[model samples]
Target: MSKPSYSKGLVGVIAGESAICTVGTGQGLNYRGYNVNDLAEHSTFEEVSHLLLYGHLPNKRQLEQYIRRLANFRQLSTAMRAVLEQLPGSSHPMDIMRTAASVMGSFEPEDENPNNEKQRNNQWECGDRLIAIFGPALLYWYQYHKNGTKIETRTGPNDTVAQNFVKLLLQTDNPDPNMVRAVDVSLILYAEHDFAASTFGAIVTTSTLSDVYSSVCTAIGTLRGPLHGGANEAAYRLISQFKTPDEAEQGLLKLLKEKKIVMGFGHRVYRKGDPRSPIVRDWARKLSEIINTPYAKNLYAVAERMEQVMMREKKMFTNLDFYASIVYHFCHIPTDFFTPVFVIARTSGWVSHIIEQRQDNKLMRPISIYTGPDPAKTPYVPIDKRLERSKL
Candidate 1:
């Protein structure tokens, strides 16, 4: 019997072993028992970090200290800063992040002893290291090339991730309060998804007994492509290319006529629609208002209409990428840094999957029915004898 083709998107098929969270009817995504939408409103990114790491939301006292922990753990090792400073300033932000994460693993390994008391402390520190320094590491290396001048990352201790990141990037302590809130909400929106392609990529990496940094680096690299996390950047590019929804619609129709795929228009999972669309979309809309960008307004209109049209025409619904593009754009994120922010948020899920995979670690090598030439045949080609095949 021939292999049956999947319904094009692995929509309902089990692609691999996953004890990580799962998405189900209505595109509902949860980690453990906590709903993602609820968490986005009620919790900060730091609290969500606690949830993913400790398996539950912290109570009042626990949460207070946990917040303190995140704040206190914000400093980067001097060596790490030095390393970031020394990197050839002309590197891609994602490359800089991946390199920094890997190097951080070398310098800061988490507690490996399964039963060690230091495990909790070590894990928290490790996460704080990633969360706290990721922006500084990328921006420091970035500005070194752009300006040939070193940038100071600390803005005299901004408390929140968004605030600190803005201060670090802008070299100013006076980050807008609303801007920080929006960026923080964006991080919450992106923090976790149930076994997304790149998160699965992280799980598979950890299943090989690799370190967390390596697993996260792998996830980042995997997310940097158009088929996955790169869709946000692609969506931004597409919107930027067109001046209005009318133009975007015309371009989209032309492309569809030519049988070309539109970036961020559809998804493999959401046959009906991505439930996250309205949530993230509204945030972008609000931020567009706050930021006062004509591009944001036009992009929002274009994306909404495109989603409506694509659903009517192709039956493929908009996924997280569509709205995420507008939100990232509103956040003033560089197009290239699109997926790195994704990496920052999704690291929690990556760590969760890493822990899950380690629970019963097994190599994820799947077997296929061998249908190629059998091993018994001995076929050798002489180097001088070649067949000249005509191009079709």
Candidate 2:
């Protein structure tokens, strides 16, 4: 037998590759057989989510009913809103999202019904709870501090999450359809990737037969780090530090000389190009035209130019985070709230992966290659002359 092997990330383990379609590959992503692109282009977020959890895209009639169910679910219970209000406005966006997810669990915990419709139904409710409450949880805390007014997210039209979110957040019934479309496709594109670290963390939690809420909570905590979903927020912050392409290029050269990463430049996957980049870049370009901000236009140009320089200097292309930063900014996402918005879109992908992992379950436990001393003998110290561990 071969000697036991150890790898830190299990990065290429191919834990389970779905026959599901993909986008970076030119084909649209389908959960089992239905396309998420088709759903985003033609169907509602509710319908797409239902397809993932239920194993088939809904028919027209089924979709209609699904939309109504999601509409009802959009209203966060009074307690959830209250919880959001209690959180300090200064809390990290991920902290706020994870707290909302964990506390909402107390309001709607999944029932124990393995491999059955009831379990699926409960998971759907939990899914609805997340999609529904995210904006409210985010905005309630945001507006309360920014404008000192209590905001309500229950007030959007019966339509797509993208459309409804724009309407609710902007407090306008008439939002540009193209803007909504941009948001919809962004959700679709980020919806799933094969076992990113955060997805694996969700799988590990759910693999324990933990409730759906627990799994989601665990996933959000992991995603809050800079190496994962939080990278977009870091990317925006990095871009904002430079006022012009020349400045950014100079700063990046300095960082490279010091052997530091320029956030949003490289990816753990996609060696040559990230397929998702062009899609979001188009959206960012369109939104720059629509929002008509000089900074927005300048920022986009600077980022693209920087990407070109990095390719020449460091041989790295812009990844999803690069374009996602500018697009999300033009979408009215505050720099600090970038990752929270990511949590909103990525919840669909995260939960779907969690469900899929449990269906064909395995413990994700991995061995570590230890390099420390095998075992140092403990030395005795006088109790009367005790020293603190830090001092020692």
Going through the candidates in the order shown, the clash numbers are 0, 0
- Candidate 1: where is the Cα deviation over 4 Å? 1-20, 114-121, 156-158, 293-295, 380-392
Whole-model lDDT values for every prediction: 0.73, 0.73
Q: How does residue 318 of candidate 2 score in lDDT?
A: 83
Root-mean-square deviation (CA) per prediction = 3.4, 3.4
Worst 10 residues of 1 by lDDT: 116-125
- Give the alpha carbon lDDT tens digit for every residue of 151-215 in model 1: 76655432777777766666666777766776777777677776778887887787777777888
Deviating ranges (above 4 Å) for candidate 2: 1-5, 16-47, 114-121, 375-392
- Compose the digit string of candidate 2's lDDT tens values, residues 1-392: 45567555665566666543353444434555665545555655666666665667788888777766666677767888788878887888788888888888887777767655223556766776687678677777778877788766666435767776777666677877877777777776666665677777887888777877888888888888988888888888888888988988898888889998788887776666776677777888888887777887788878877887899998998878888888877777687777777777778777777677666776677567665654565566689888667742
Query: Residue 38 CA error for candidate 1 (Å)?
Result: 1.4
